[model samples]
Target: MIDRVPAQFRGVADGVVAVAAADPRFLAVIVNGSVANGQPDEWSDLDLVVVCADPYRSEVVAQGKDFAAAAGPLLVAFTGEHVGEPRLLIALYGPPVIHVDLKFMGLGDLGERVEDGLVLWQRHDSVQQQLDATSAAWPQPDAQWIEDRFWVWIHYVAAKIGRGELFEAVDGLGMIRSAALVPSIVARRTDRPTGVRRIEQLAPEMVPALARTVAMPDRADCLRALRAAVELYVEVRGDDVVQQTEAEKAVLGYLDGFPA
Candidate 1:
């Protein structure tokens, strides 16, 4: 299955390059996003960044639509340029919708401001220095911010669940985002990643037992998850800071209004 998809991607990529190469302004071509991140699932899309000498050149901008259409009868959703960077979102005529985000960057203008990107093709040594400098500046998740938001967001999740707002409740949970911080803290405490998935998988036994503190039943599982989420937040935070605050109190009051 993977072998077949790459073949299709190659065909589309080759067509894009062939059209792009016709113009001398185009300096290089890069493919980034999930595909470059080494985490492509079956649903992943081909995110291509077209690096050119002048990204805003009349010829390049004009050809953007045509370049996308070269992918055959696929439905192309063009998101235009962001801060002068052109983009396209495409879905091919296949079961798995293939998304392609195209960005045009100028050679001389490519600088330290950009994120770490792969150099699929390069015309000169200038892009090398910029790519290396940008790579060094990759954003690391802020530990203090994550720690502060954990407790505060849990109360919001509880209130959302209590109110029967499932989508908002799930978003408020932030399990995946908060989970990233836990592994780092746990690694510091246990000296290993532990390769756990959900917070419950690696939650310490010594933390306050939440079974009695949080109510649960067959119908209110989302509320259970929300309460468990709060307990996990308290566990990860430790005594580094107190969970109780004016904002948390207000959120708890809001949740209290929605009786179990």
Candidate 2:
């Protein structure tokens, strides 16, 4: 069984909520993600949102990290205001790495936005209205970007292997991220959210096929997984976008060179 969070950590969350509620500019504070989903393991971290009267009007971004940091010495890793979005802050803490993704949303407009799962811990009328307006929008992955990145990343992996950099090759073998594009495309084909991870549960058959295709016994196996990853990419994207790409040609040539 996963260890329940220490009372001190719970108090930290409560304290954060209290701080937000006391501020006139802050209308509501929502606890979301893993904790909200109730699937928290011992290493789980808090994901929260601080809904403000005006998203861009206040300095919520600057203060959020400071606030979380002040809560504990474990809050050492900070990803400052992701992707130029002032309304969000991402941080990590604890030895095992717990992530906290904090977002600031406009009070009146909060309900208009949609997130998959949100649990409101503290809310005013204005905040509740905003939360009510929230809609659920599935995130879309950039297929073209994934396609291009797959080839580039694999070639780098191949080069590392060629240079006898086994550790680097293993470290770089993040086929999961590459394999994710396939499921995203499949999900879109089935009319669901794209870019959703842990999709093996959705389609168990694909998981084994993916594993088989990407399995490698040694350096050769690494290359095999890479080739399979490329072929899988082609299968997902179709020939039109990826057919003429070098990755496609390389996989084909590799198959040709395979000994009988």
Error of 1 at 44 (Å): 4.3
Candidate number with greatest TM-score: 2
lDDT of 1 by residue, 14-96 (tens): 66666666666777777665556565666667777776665455566566666667644456556554434443333353323
lDDT, candidate 2, 1-56, per-residue tens: 01233343465566566667667777666776566566766666676777776754
Instruction: Give stretches of model 1 more than 4 Å off.
Output: 1-5, 33-44, 54-63, 71-73, 80-97, 108-117, 132-136, 174-219, 237-258
Number of backbone clashes in candidate 1: 0
Q: Least lDDT summed over 10 consecutive residues: which range in candidate 1?
A: 210-219
TM-score of each: 0.62, 0.66
